[model samples]
Target: MTVTNTGATPARIRLAYTLPAGLSDAGTGGCAPAGGGEHRCGEWASAPGARFSTLLRVRVDGDAWKRMPLSGSVRVTATAPGAPGVVSDDEGFAVLFPPGPPVPGIRLAADAVSFDISGGSSGLEVRLGNTGRVDAEGRVEVALPAGVTVPTPPSGCTTVSPARTRCALGTLAAGRTARLRLPVTATPEAQRQAPLAGAVLGQLDPRSGPTRQVQMSFRITSAAALATPVASPPAPTGSQGVLAAEAPAVSDGGGGGSVRRTAILLIVISTLLVVFALALATTSLRRRMTAPVAGPSAAPTE
Candidate 1:
C-alpha cells in the first residue's frame, strides 16, 4: 500500500505488483520520499480476475542508508473475482551494510583486531564512539558455536563468564570514544577446522543493570594451514640485553668459556709446584747424611 526510500544513501526501490479486476484507474503510480510515510495512489482494477503490475521507483538519501542495515517486509494481497481482497506473503528482505562508519552510536575507526588459532588466544578489538545524549559504559562479548574456539581475547580483556568475555569501557561522553579488547581461549577441538561467529555488545554500567547495547555478527574460518601458528620474528624488546627470564645460556657467550679454562690451568700449576718443593727437601736430607761428622770423635780421643 506504501513505498519509500529506506537507505542512508540515495537508492531506487522498484516494486511491481499485480492488481485485481475492474478497479484499474489512470495515474496509478508515484514515488515515496525518504523516511517513507503513507501515500494514496489511483485505484488499480479493471475487470473480473484481471492481473496488473504496480511499479514504484524511489531515490533514497545517502545519510539514511548509513544508519542501519536496511530490512523490510513485503505484503502481497489478492482479491476475489469481484469480492474483497486478502493479504498474502509478508516476507522480509534485509539489505547488507558495510562494516564501517555512519552507523548510529558506533565508531569502528582505528581498531586493530585479529584472530589466530596457533596455540594462543585470538579475538577482536573495537572502538566505540558515543553520539547519544548520555555517556556510555560498555563492552564487547563474543561466542563461538560448537566445535569452534576462541583462544583468548586481546590483552586487557577478561573473560567474565564461561562463554562470555567482557571489557569494561568506563564512560564515554557524547562525541568521545572508548576502546574494547575481546580475547578468547579455545579448546583444541575448537581450534580444529571450524567456523567462528563473534558478537560485540555495548553496555552502560559496571554493575548489573539494564544495558543499552549494539551488536554485530561476523564469521571466522580456520583452514589447514592455520593448524600451526607461524612464528613471528621476535620483536626487539628495546633493552640493554635479554632479561634473566629469557635464555641465560648466552649470558657470557664469548667470555665465560675462556674464564673456565684459565681457572683449570691455574689449579694444575699449583699442584706441580707442591710436588717440586717436596722433592727438593728429600735431596737435602740425603746430602746431610753423606757429610757425617768425624771431627767430634777425634776430639774425644785426645
Candidate 2:
C-alpha cells in the first residue's frame, strides 16, 4: 500500500498492514548486521503469520528516503536525514519509511521530580516520581543531601557521587513513566542535621539533537529527628558530690533572709506609729493648759 502525507504542516503519521496467507520470508531483506541472519522487512511480503512486515520508501516533498527502526506499529514523523522519527508497534513487522526534513528543535516541560527518603544507616532508599519527559539521551541524576548516602543504582544506574547516582533510561519516550529507587548509607551525623539538597533528573541528550529533552527539579528534605536517650545522666562524684551536698543549706539561707526582711519592715512601721501618737498627745495637753489661763482672767473681770 502507498501512504502519502497531504497535510501542509509536517506531522508524525502511523500506518498498519496485514500480510497475505501462506508466505514465510520471516521479513528478512537479505541484508543484516554481521553474523546475523535474522528476518528483514522484504521477506515479510508473503508471511502467513498473524502479523506481517512492509517496507515503504517515504519521500517527502523535498527530502530523501531514510531507514527507521519499527517494532509493532511504525511511527513516522517529519524528521531530518539519518535520524528519522521511528516508533514500534505491538505486532511483528519490519518497517521502512522516507526521511524527514530537519525539524525545528522542540522543547518539553522538564519532568517534575520528587524524592522520598527512606531506610537508615544500614542503607538509605531514594524513591523518585513525577518525571515529565526527556526527548533525548544522557543520564537520570539524583543528588542526595550531604550526610545521606545512596547505594549504587540497580543494574542500569550509574553512580555520580558517593551520595548521588543515575539510571540509564536511554531515549525516554514522550509521556513515559519512570521510577527508580536508590539505596545509600546515612553518615554518622546525618541524624543530627540531615542535609537537604536539590536533585536533578535529566536526559543526557545534547543541546542540539533531533530529539528534545526536559528536566525536573526535586526539593529534598531530611527525614532525621532527634533520638531519645535510653538512659539518664549519672551522679557526680567526690568534689562534685560535696557541692551537690551544700544545695540544701543554700536554700535554707535564702528562706532565713526573706523572714528577716519581713520582720524589719514590721518594726519600722510600729516605731513610726508610736512617734505619731506621742505628738498628738502633746498637742492636746498644750491646748488644755492655754484654755485654763483664759478662764481665770475672764472670771476676775466679771
* Highest TM-score against the true fold, candidate: 1
Candidate 2, residues 123-225, lDDT tens digits: the string is 3233222233444454566655555555556878777767567677655454444445555555544433322333443443533444333333332323432
Candidate 2 residue spans exceeding 4 A from truth? 1-135, 204-224, 229-232, 235-302
Look at candidate 2 and tell me the lDDT of residue 204: 36
Candidate 1 global CA lDDT score:
0.42
lDDT of 2 at 9: 23
Off by over 4 Å in 1: 1-103, 106-117, 147-160, 205-211, 223-302
Clashes of 2: 25
Predictions in order: lDDT: 0.42, 0.37
| lDDT comparing candidate 2 with the true structure | 0.37
| Candidate 1 accuracy as TM-score | 0.33
